[model samples]
Target: MTVRRPAHEPAEPLEERLRKLEKINRALMGRVERSTDFSGNGFSLFQTAIVLEGQVSARTSDLKRTLEDLSDAYARLEDARDDAEEAKQNLTSAIEAVSEGFALFNDAEELVMCNTPFRALLPDIETRLAPGTPFPRIAEFFSQSRHLVLDQHRSPEAWRAARIDLFRKPHAAFIQKLSQDRWIQVSNKKTDTGATVVFQTDITDIVRAERLRRERELDEQSKILQATLDHLPQGICMFASDLRLKAWNHRFIDLLSLPLRLVTPLASFERIWEWAGKSVFVHDGAGVAAVSGWLRAPSADLDSIELGKSDGSILSVSGNVMPDGGIVVSFADVTEERRASAALREAKETLEQRVEERTAELTREVIERRAIEVELIKARDTAEELTKSKTRFLAAASHDVLQPLNAARIFLSLLGGTGLDLRQQHFAGKVDKAFGSVEEVLGTLLDISRYDSGSVEANIVPLSVAEILTTLAAEFQPLADQKQLRLRCMPSGLYGLSDARLLRQIIQNLVSNAVRYTTRGGVLVGARRRGGMISVEVWDTGPGIPADKRDFIFEEFRRLNQDVPDTPKGAGLGLAIVRRIARLLDHPIAVRSVIGRGSCFSIELPLCAPPRRVEHKASAERLPVDLASFTAIVIENDLAILEGMMELLQERGMRAIPAVSIGEALETLQSLEKTPDLIIADYHLDQGTGTDAIAAIRRAAGHAIPAIAVTADQTAKVQAEIRKDHIAYLRKPIKTGDLFALIRKVIAE
Candidate 1:
């Protein structure tokens, strides 16, 4: 039996066929047969086939559902592929963005991928990295040599540490030759799959900064050590165990004055020791073992020592042991302090010697002073004895001397009144002249006594210099003529206020000295202008004073070139009187002389002019003197002077009257016994002065009297007082001629 079936049968549909196969697979078996049979018989199979065709039509619907499941699975597989591609791109970008160079390598040390930075390290290499390129082969192409990757465990120890490869290990360290050399840091890492990653960063600036920092720190430490050593006062040095100098400060160099080659080296100590001495060797620690004597014991150390230099300078030295088996020594010079101490000791010794000598001299001086005291007492006793002797002599002689002088003056006057022959008259004139000279001597002695005893006082007045000179010349002309010396005067019409009598004395003494000393040339009286003053000078061509003795001549009792030794003349009180008077008048006196030629004595005095007029009272007791006849009215308080004046007036052919007071004179004028021709009054009247008496007489008579005043006190103030009455003044011991001449002038006026 043969059988066949339809191709499109329901029982044999493709979907159903696959499902049946799947079902047979699910059944337990090692393997399963695939078939489209439900029953075993071929005819049954044929019959089902026709039925299966119809079922195939229904299975065709299942084909669409199976297509939708396949499309969903394909969509999920596409998404997984896209995610993997994006992750690969992100890894590439991250590698490029990092600053350090980067690369990846395989297990055999072959480059897989390299970034731009790593490519830049090798400009000649291909920009894109690929597999299976030997790392050393590529490195040699760029770096011109094998750039090995480090494998410390497999490589030789020294070479392993130094391994660096620019291509395989992108971060490998490298050197760059710039202005200066520079360094770079490199790092590498590997995954479990044996792929490597490399990183690199340039570190040249940091390395340079570190090197500079180290150098600066070293330099700073060296400077600080050197500066500290230089400031030390003592010499400092270090010696090695081999006895070589290892270090030294500036002070040690300067102390030896060593050369620069010697200064910065260890040999300087030996050179200094050669120039200075073995004394420079400090000798305990720094010195040779021979000098220290410590060679036998290795533990022996330093000792202190002092040495004096050849220049007599002392040095103090000390030594110490160092930890490195060397020695250090120091020295100080102390010469100046020693010298100062020596000088101070010497000074103290000298002072002690001086004190002893001064003490001895002072003792001798005390003994000498006692001797001088004894001599002084004896001299004082002798002076007292001499003073008593002088007092007795003056008392005994004063009365005898004055009585004889009075009698002689009276006799001379009486003889003049009588008629006399020419010879007798000539003898009478000689006697009068001799008596006048004697009176001058007595008066000068009296003046000296009065001046010395402080009894004389100045009577200052204003007077004309012309008048003083005229009066002096009138008194001294005869003496000047007898001596044949011209006594000349320069007219000084100037006036001054001074004691007129004292001024006259000063001038008279100077003039007398001039006349006595002068022989041929004239004596000149003149005045020179001083500041606010007039300096009156008496100059003569006389024996000038010797320069040696000129100052001595003005002293009391000094005489010069005296020829008339027995005359009892000047008594040498003249210049002394002049000096005293100049002092009294507050005038300055000076003398100048030339030996054997002349002398000049000058007196400086303040200048004053006379007043315009002097007022006076009128006298009425006397009539005016007759024009032809000489008449006189004599007023004398003493009867002797009154009678003497009366007799002298009558002899001169002038009528005279005597009244003692102003009232008596008025009564006498009223009686009209005789109207006096000229009035003469003694300055001292009984009731009032002659000046008042004269005024009374003039009032009664109704006219001024041509009166003359007579007084023995010849002081300038007394003369001025009398002259204030507008009358003629005369000094007592009156001369007959002056009396007659004054009366004649009044009558003539």
Candidate 2:
């Protein structure tokens, strides 16, 4: 069955349908008027209907293409929407990945988004922190939950107002602390859309490090202060505001002699005061009060106090005030300086008293001495005149006395040498011994005179001690043997600056005394080296002197009793002469003795370097065999001495000429057929001295004749005169052997 279409629904083109309908209507009207023209009109209407159907087909194809293009555009729009959603998911993931809390706020100050860390920052209010939550509400939740740890004194309203105010202002970084004492640094940045991005960083480690650095600095400062206090010389102690010992140095303990156990930081000042009062400041009554007062008002400055102790020590104590109600004290010891000042004051007083007494005594002595001085001067003049007379008498008497003695000695010697019976020889020896004693007494008198007159001048030279020892040994050996005593002289190589003649005399007297006193054992003569001097000591096993007599022995004419029967007694002038000679030579003498053992006598002589070598005449000890061929001239003022000298020379087998004066000697030489080999002259001549007579004869003969001066003048002036003439000098009553030796030595030369 075919459905009928509604009239409003047109299935074909309107223009073509409208044209067909119009043609059919026009033909119906015309046929009614003229039915014969209907076939031609129907054909024109059919062509118009065909054109309308073609146009309707083209329009339907164009509408179908437009519908397909609209479907493709809708599919592209769906793809772009999916890509935008994926980009938003990536941005949210990156924000959540950060370790710090991060959040974003919109322009209206509402919470738009936040990471999990931001939510964790406020865990109690994390549920309230969501998108579209206002910042003021979040701040209120943080305050209620105590999440931000804001000021405890501030109200919640104020805290919320402050947070809102900070949020609305231009974004900046600031710090926040949590209620758990963790630190957070908040940094905010404003976006282009007027939202804020906040980053919170935990900074607890940095805060702890800063705190530790401050602590270390404080510790260093404390150490430096302690070191400075310890090095101070003065004892130091510091008390704190609580009136307790806060610090002290080791010196403080040492200075006060405090117990170590009682001293420590925060120790009570009262306890220290009690200990100091009992020990160090035993006598000071103010010590306890001072400590109490210092502790009570530690900021008050105090003056230094000088406190004394029972043990004779003094302490200077001073205190200073600290700004923080504390006290610093120092101590100094001042004992020695105070004592020294007192001693000096006492000495000054004593010295002044002594000076006053001495001055008074001197004033009295000056008055008394004036009266006695006049008498002393008169006595001294009289004594001097007597001494001069004594000297002249001895000089005059020596020649007269010695002239006969010398002749007797020569005759006795000559008679002994001749043929004689034993009895006659014994008689001659006895007489010779008597003459020897007389000669000794006279010689001693002469030596004492020379010393008293100061005529024995010292001719100091460098002489070997060995040489003097050798001579002494040879001279004393016979004496020692006669007494059955050993005499020894130890070899010495030391030299001294001394007068050889005076030294020999001093040693001879000592040795002679030794030999005289000793009857057994030996005498030892030796030298020892002392600093810058040589000690020539004579040790003898003699009848040792008694202690009481030791000092008296050196006095003139003081003798000890002789114990040995066969030992000869001395005139006691030996040691007396020794004392005088030692004094003249400026040498010190010492004597040590034991009653039964022996004695040692030592003389100190200055040590000297050996002198330059000089040609010295060899010592003559014996007559030569050529004595008989020598000729001699004798000049003497005394007839007996002249004959004695002539006979002694002739007996020794030599030609001898006797002349009483220089004129006689000159005449005797002119009458001689040859020049005399030697001249022997007397120093005290009627014409001139022996030296003058010899000079006259030497001039007449036109040559320097080898001469000998025989003089009774023992004065140094006469001896020096003879020596100045280069002639040998012989003392009065000369020994026969010595004269012969001198004659032989001179002629041989």
Candidate 3:
């Protein structure tokens, strides 16, 4: 390697040293000539030669040292050259291994070096793209490859011009879509030395993914728009700016009454209009021109036209201009609306005449209605008065008729206990039973009337099923025995939400019906839980009620034709009363039966929490343990009822005192030996209530004493008033056993 010295080393170098040596040799030769000329002596020549030899030896040594310096400088230059070559190879390898196509361009806009990937772009011109290749030439070769896609640049010259324009910018980047659907992100950036570096990264996957996503979104939106159009009430058809039908819903065809042949791929507004026979849009040729003008102009304001068909129907066509210069036309069939409007107009024209006629007719009707209403009011008052009379009669019978009935019942009880013959006793029993039947029928009729009048309200309360069933079992035991049919009362711990009296009456009627119908097998009355309700069912093995007759059996005075004549028939109002009571209590009553098998009558009652413990009412069969000592003050308005009650009490071994009114009861209590054990008074007395009598007698007696308010008036008001004074209540005609049991219960307390 040849080494050149650095400029800063020295102004004079090895050449300067050699030129000085030549000058020294010239001066020595001149000295030798001078010596030879001056003395022509060999000694001078010998001295000069010795000096010259010493100088030569010194100069040679200097030259040897200068040569050694040049060798060392050459070795350093070789090392630097080797390092630069290694660095060039490393840079080449780095750019070659890069994932992106990398190219370096010189300041002269010439390609200096490029990676293999960049060369791959111009595969056919790979060898031509040597170092220092002009950038324009390389770009020209690349543009000819046809792999790059250009935006707004279909021609090759335009794409190349765009690329050159971007290259001139300080820094630029653009996405290049290639043939075969490939993509490249090309970034052109400048280096510090005014050279440009370009990087092209493949983004085919990203571009494809984004495009696919957009296409899917557009497809979904198109489907949604089509669906929306299909569901629109008005018919719709959209036309492109070219007037070709782009989309249409089925309603458009239906409204236009057009044939399917006109709806082919070549369908257009002109074709349909031409086929429309010119009657739909023609208005002396002026309407046609106006419609044609608007249809041709994509930017026209919204317009609408109404058309009439030959069939006397009407169609309203409205057009809207979309942002895309397309038109959406809607067709509305307004035949009914147009006809109705015409009718309304015609009606309006004659409205005054009609109004006058209607007014006069209304006036006449008003007069007639007024007369009819007056008569209706009179009839209503009469009906209401009749209802009131019936209610009053029921109330009157409760006090007057039931008063005698109570007295009669007690007298019959006394008569039955006497020493009468068997035949006399049987007749007495029949008469007594006749009285009972009369009482039952009258009571049932009164109840039915009250229910019909909507006057009976149930007193809803939680009642123990076991207690009610037990009492009913004992009461019906004799009747069951007489009929030779088994009666079973299943004990239940369930409680039911119902009116106690109404509930008992419902059950009693059911049991009676069961016993009356059954000639053989037993009757079972029990309660069972049904979901949240308790069903009290009466199951009897008898000739079952026919499915057809079951509904009618509950009607008034309806009875099955009895085969056994011995089975005493009732008025058949028991089930009727049951139905009314069940309705009053809002309990659901139902019956299921099979022919020749049996019948089950069931009533569903809501289940309720257990009622609070209350003092049990007296058992009708029970009496006071020390009956003789138990004295009762009896107050009654009716003398007959008073006498009978006194006799009954005395018969039960109680000392009885009597009063006809509150004053009499107070006076009787004042004269009593011991404050009466119990005070029993009629609810409706001459001048006061049973509560008033009991209160007066108790005040006169100077202590709180047990009392009972007895009444044949079974009205709720009477019962509530009697119970308000904390007195036991008994309704008439009272059973003898109930009276005794009440007396026993009162005295024990």
Candidate 4:
């Protein structure tokens, strides 16, 4: 082989051989193209080598390598076909295992293959190998857009490398939307038989998962927004453009005690706002207007409102544009803080007013207290001065007047026993009557002194009013006769327990006043019975008491008359003495009068038990005297009084024995030899009192005789002395009737 013939064969290397084969292939291709026709000839070399002979050798030695190459290519194609079948089976099994349906269709738009799941997706189909089943038949079974692409014409490599994408057409996710509920993927390609390969994938769960993801994201964002609104201090709300409330928080609803309708669909926030604004007219309309003015705010500028709630609460409102173009409002209640501030201001004002008022009241009280203190001091000083003046007057009156009065009475009694003729007796009686008047005036002054000094203690005793009246009649009748005024005493025998001396003074004063004031008309002294009491009245028919002057007539030192013309006068003390005695006896005194009419002065005495019968009889015995057969001796030191006594005795049917001195009385008694039945001694009897004369007369007669000490001494000491001697004492200005009564009593005993 290594000969020359092998050397020629070595001329063609591996690269040269490949070139030769390519050349031969071209030649053969050209020959076949030229010689044969594809139109039913069936004798083309290319077809013959490829299909029938399977030979078109380029070189004898390269033939085996080419055959081997053809074999390996065939083996790979067989393996790929087997792998495609296995993959189809696995895909079918997987689709059946899934919950959804799946289907496969051929390029002819017919059902070629389908899994059990796909059959389930069909309405009533059993197998997938049905003929003439259109590829669009499954469109109704699927819920979304399905695509069928014929990929059977594509080589496997091309199919894998080809760009593919899937998308579900726009459709409603709900089955009621008349869209396919299930989905598939169909791929078609150009092949020898013009068929297609199709795959159907049910994508309903994927569609649902995508929708759930979107919903979860939306829910989370909404929760975030709601949480932010809730955490805000102010209440938030949304309202329609028509002013109807859509939603609200708790705070906005509770602020006004208002019905929900006001801010709800029934009424509206717009109408409620108008009403609330008008109600705020009291606190200045700015607040209400500001709240109501929010309607015109721009979207960027939030509306703000200051609201005053009906429950004394204040609210701040803010509103803004919502994403959906609705009104969103916020409110906060500030009631407690506002109330606290108002209360603080009010308390301050009240405190200031109280301070001012208290200061004014204190000033007024201080001034009033000072004025009262000064007035009290002045009153005290005036009282002291008045007390001193009264003491001096009382002392001077008793000493200067009473001493001369006592001596003159004694001289008058002494002179009465030594009387001569009627002319001499008459002259002596005139002097005695003049002196008697002076003594009577002195006794009245003593009574007034006792009353003013509060020293007149009452000696309450039971006595007969009748007897008292009778005695007063006898005492006052002569005075009444002299004044030409009738003195009538009508007595009621009413017994009363009272101060006897005071009672007598009251009656005497009443009678004396009647005589003094009366010009012509009569005076009356009487008693009448009342309920549990006796009213003793003194009535005068003279110049009647004036109505204006009646009230003050009984007051001390008060005189009803400014002028009087009577010769015998009073010191305006008679009625005053009556009032004082009435008070001392606890008797109520009253007067009734009319201008120019008569006046009546009355005393109401309370009734009490009668005294012993003996005391009553003694009082009665001293009433009126019968001077028909009585005889009395007149003894006085003064000539006038001695003569007056002798005339008075002679007039009373008594023998006259006038003595100018006590010695003359002794001579008369000795000469008479009968020791005259009674001795009439004067207190001023020629330097001896009537009491001294009584003792001297008994000494001269050498026997004790019934005698009377007649004097004007009204002092307690004088009265006590006279009582101690067991002699009757009579005060002067002694009337004829009183004198006769004393004489009769002394002689009868």
Candidate 5:
């Protein structure tokens, strides 16, 4: 590059201009002298001298100003040169300070500058990396250098061609692995000045760490696979694609009896198999090619080949090709299994003869068979009492476990009746409600067990529909009233044929359940005649049952709220019993319900002539006697039960007293204002028998006094004893409906 002066500045040096100007002045003076001597005219010479002198002085002044301008321009040019040199030093220092090897190339692709690392990385070409060297030359040196880790599969020519092709790209980054196992990341970036900068970063540590992790993982996997193969029960051997043995467990050697030298690593599978010995099929026309053939070209199917030895041993051989083209073969001894199968076949062929011999003894079995069957029938009939495996563990559960259970319920019920604070009543109500649930579960279980054993007999008979319904209403009205629900019953003079006892129980259960679940509206019981049938429907305004669950509701242990997580109260057996009873009576029951409205259960009964029996239980003349008005003596061997019954009766406004045993009965009677209206005594009392105590109490009162014997033991012996005394018998739980009806009936008689 050349430096040119500005247009207004002098082209020549000030000293040179001064020298030329002085020389011209001297020439003019010489000319003046010559004119003076040659022309011989002093006047002309004098004029020439003045003019020459004046001109010389003006020329001198102009030279001085020209020199000053040149001096200022030279000073500014020097400062500019210094600043350019400083900038160059700063750029050089900055590039050297960078960690990565830096090299800059001009737009012509020629090397402009480079840091120490750039040439340091390529020691072989260090001398060649100069300012004049082109970018392609450096790339060629890098590709051909001994340090370059070239691909073994690729020709050096191809790798070089690709590397050079990428040199001119605007932005490029690639990884270059050195022969020394170092990793370098190289990036080529274009500068705004139409230059390119290459950066090479060493990532040896990171790459080595990653490779180590991968190697460790592969090693662990190898160890795990070997361990699993060694522990396998079957003899196993794995071969590489080349059909050379890669792995084999000791079992393979022992099972096949192969030579140890033939089963070593890199041993040919063909040689190993040959030494393992030839296996021929026990059955003709069943054979397979050598496993080595499958190793060469395996199919997806993995069926096994069976081979038998001369010693009556059979082997099952199976093989599969691995994902990496390796093949694994397994051998299993199935000798025992094969023999057992053959024996089973032989037995089946000869089984008819044994059956014939057994059948021939039929004549002799007649007497003994009847005797065995008779014993089985008797055992099943009294299964609950004798076996203790049915009927809620047979009647024992009802007596032992439920004795305290009944007492708890009674006490809880009595507590709810007391005028405690709101919170106390709420808690007591929940406790009582829980006890009721337990009773329902136990009762339902007992009912299910009895039904299963065919112990519950359905006694079908003629019954008055109106009287039955009136009795049901009277029994459940108090329960409904407690919940502030209305119980509506439409009296029907028309009667239908049904079991009086069971029909009452069915309607009674329906009304009782309706009162229990109904939180609003009421339960409506009405009857309508449809042609030759009477439909006795019970409707309840409660959480309606789903249509899907309508049939399921009658299933034992099934509830209407099965879809929700919350388990609703009730053992889900009420409707189940209803279904069973309806079937027994030849009555078809139907149910219709809406999601939020209510449910109606209708029992279709065949229409029949009115019954001849007259029922005056609901007559207006007889005052509605709820057990609340009467007084009774509660004789229970269990103190808790005695207290619970006394509290329960008194809470309902009855003048009741407690008697723990037979001895307490006399004391309780002597304390009563009037010979207690009724006697409620447990059969298994503390001392002397409860029936004996009841007889004594009756003798003291001078009349029967409406005696009722309550007992946890429902055995035939206990019931017979209570009945022989002419007293009433109720089960352990003492169902309120049955108890109340029995009490009223016994009192009236």
Candidate 6:
């Protein structure tokens, strides 16, 4: 009857089933004893027990399925929690990577999170700014530690209150200056959860740049104002409201005769006024009071006051007041104008008196006027005679003055020919330079005399312009080379009707002027056709003439003030002489100039056809013949000149015969065994003229001997006389080069 129970069944359920079976058996026995019915009831009870067993197995299966479902749901919930934690960590790392300081606060104003820079911004209270820290407490900590530097005018408590007020309701971003002179821009934004995020950025460099830009603008304005004041014509001085000098110009110092040290900026006006009173203004008793009253006036339109000094100087001073309570004063020197006005008033009064007196004596004056007229005429004639006498004296004394200079020049030339040391040569060169200066002065005087006396005559003939320009270029080439300037002469196949010698002189002077004034570039000589005449122009790259001064430059003793370095100033007579010579030759001279560019001087001469053939003279090269093989006869009025000539000739290894008169020259030539090869005679002899002496010498020699006429007279008549005799002429003081070249040429012919 022991049936096997299922191995998987619960022990408690099985035991309870066994106990219930025993109880049912006992209840069946009792029922059997009590009542013997066992039919339909027994069958119904057996079916009910079977149905209960099936229901128990179904309930056990349902409980097991419910337990498995609960375990799977628990695993899904744990995975979701892990994903949420990783998302939170990523958000924090992103916020910490920002360069700017960052902080977050909850709605209750308690600190939620903060980056390292946020805490570093307030290093003293870095721990206090941790999580859960109240915003008000953080502000209190900053205020106590002096971490935030408010405006200098605000107290810490007031600033903290204001900052808290702003924190409660932030409008926009604001900049705060921190301790140690650092600057920060702070911005606040609200998150979706009602928390606040604060961003801080350093802006010190931007602030510094703004300050520098303002400083540069101020400096530029100051420079412009200073330049404007300096360039003003009038003497200007500015004073501050306190009557201290702020600025002044050099003209102000010069006008007031103020000391240089007293003219500095920030100088007190009182010191300047005292200096002016002592040095510039007349120190009368009332001068000090008057000046003080004028300076201290509140706002007055000051009339120009003329101040007089003990040294006969007058200054006009005017004052003006600015809207800012500052003062400006102007000074002008008016001494000359005042004196002129006084003189004119006195003259006018004197003239009125004289007119009244003359009216009363008109009849008496009429009778005496004829006699006065005659006397005036005689005085005029006497003046004319004196002028003529002066001209004659100058012309006559030119030879006497130049004789010794000529002899000295020849002696110096011979001395230069001899070898010498460097120091000796330098001294000799200095002497030569002295002689050159003397020659220039003498030549100028002689030319002026000759032009004034109407002695220069123009022999107008067909002449080659190229020939003259070429000669000039050759003469001035050395000078141009020394100055490092290019000299160009264009070849012109054209001819002009002009005097060859006078034309040469005019062109030479112009070229010399061009070379002297030009600092760079070059000088060009060329000709251009104008109407029926040819204009020969000399162009130079030099400081040009002002339009106002163009006509004045041709006047006597007129020169432009051109401050070129290392260039020697001339006597200012070159243009004057050129004008005179141009008029004498009937050639028109014109000048065109620009102020800073250059100038062109041109002369118009009537154009003519060139000759069939032009024969140019031989160049002035040294001769091949020995000078000692020739005999030279010299005639002069002065013994010293005659002896000097002999000495100079003997030095040159030439045979020289000296004589003072025509008779002496003839006697000396007759004593010579052979005909004289050359004869040098002075224009004015002791007894007869040099022309007469040359004639006598030629007659005695019985041949037409070559001769030279040396003279200081540059008149056309003297030149004509020498040329008429077919003799060469050299001007005095004679150039050694010319003398030797002429002698060599004559001997060679």
Candidate 5 Cα errors over 4 Å, as ranges: 1-389, 413-419, 453-459, 469-491, 508-535, 538-551, 564-569, 583-601, 604-607, 613-633, 646-678, 686-689, 712-749
Relative to the unseen true structure, what is the C-alpha lDDT of residue 448 in candidate 2, on a scale of 0 to 100?
74
- lDDT per residue (tens digit) for residues 1-749 in model 5: 12344544432453465456567656665665554433547777788677767765765666555455556546545555666678789999999998889999998989999999877886877888889688777777777788788767876677777866776788888878886788888898888988888998888997787666545533543454455456555899888878888888888876776777677889987677654445333242243354445556764324577766546678788776554457778888888667756755565454545446667687655665566567555644654353335443544445665665666555555544544434345655555564565566666665555555455565556567888888788888887887788898997977777777767767776776677666788999988898988888899997787878888778765655433422234555788888777776778888888877888888877678865655666644554577677888888878767776776666567777777877678987787778888888887765777788889999888887778888766544667789987888887676555766777787776
Q: How many collisions per candidate?
A: 18, 0, 0, 58, 0, 0
Best by TM-score: 6
**What lDDT, from 0 to 1, does candidate 6 have?**
0.76
Estimate, for each residue in 1-749, the C-alpha lDDT of model 4 and write its tens digit: 11112212322243354456566656666765565334544456457546423323434435555445445444444555666678778986786786544444455557666666545544443443355676554343232222222234644334223322121211112121112543333333434554544443455565556556545633443343344344444676667666566656555555544455565643576677665555533454676666556544424324345666554567876665443346667677766545655655675565556557667687765575566557545655655556545644563355334444444554455555553334346755765764565455456666776566665567777778888888998899887887787788895768987777788878887777777777777888999888888888889876788777776677554554434434233445577778777777789988887656577878887776666664343333544556554444566766645665666566556667777777777777778847766778776566777787788888877877878877654555677788688788876545555766677787666
Per-residue lDDT for 1-749 in model 3, tens only?
44555433433354455456556656665665564433447888687777767766766676566556656455545555666678789999999999889999989999889888877754676888888888887778767875665556377777788889898789999877777788788899888889999998888897777666545633543454455466555898888888888878889888877788887654777878776646454432554555566788745434457776767677777776554467778888888766756755665555545556677688765675576567657765876787677666555554655555576677778767754434456766765775677578667776786776666678888889888888998888898898898999988999888888888988988988888778887999999999999999999998888889988988876667443455555766888988888888888889899888999999999998897887998766743377887788888878867888888888867888888977777776667667878888888877978888788877777887998888766667777878787799987888998987877777676
Cα-based TM-score, every candidate: 0.39, 0.49, 0.47, 0.36, 0.40, 0.50
lDDT of 4 at 309: 55
lDDT of each: 0.61, 0.75, 0.75, 0.60, 0.70, 0.76
What TM-score, to 2 decimals, does candidate 1 have? 0.39
Q: Rank the candidates by TM-score, best first.
A: 6, 2, 3, 5, 1, 4
lDDT of 1 by residue, 1-749 (tens): 11222322332243454455455434422221232467678888887787666555544444344344334334434444555567768988998887777878888888777778766653445543455676655444433312323333544343433444333443444433222353456567767787777665666687677556545633443444354445556788767676667668877766645565655545644555555554333333333433244322224333445555545665665565443457667766656645655655665565456556667676564454344345434544544444444433432233333333433454467556665434456766766775675556555654554454444577677777777777887777888898887888778778777878788889988888888767777888877666668788999898788888777787765766644332223456688778777877788888898887899999877777666876788745655554336455567766644655566556656556667777777777887755666677766665777777777777777888688776555444666778887888865456666756676665555
Lowest summed lDDT across 10 adjacent residues in model 1 is found at 1-10
Could you tell me which 10 consecutive residues in candidate 6 have the lowest summed lDDT?
1-10
lDDT at 666, model 6: 78
lDDT of 2 by residue, 273-306 (tens): 7788887777787865675575676544455677
The candidate with the higher TM-score, 2 or 6, is 6
**Residue-pair clash count for candidate 1:** 18
The whole-model C-alpha lDDT of candidate 4 against the native structure comes to 0.60
- Where in model 4 is the C-alpha error above 4 Å? 1-400, 406-437, 474-488, 519-521, 555-569, 611-713, 716-718, 730-748
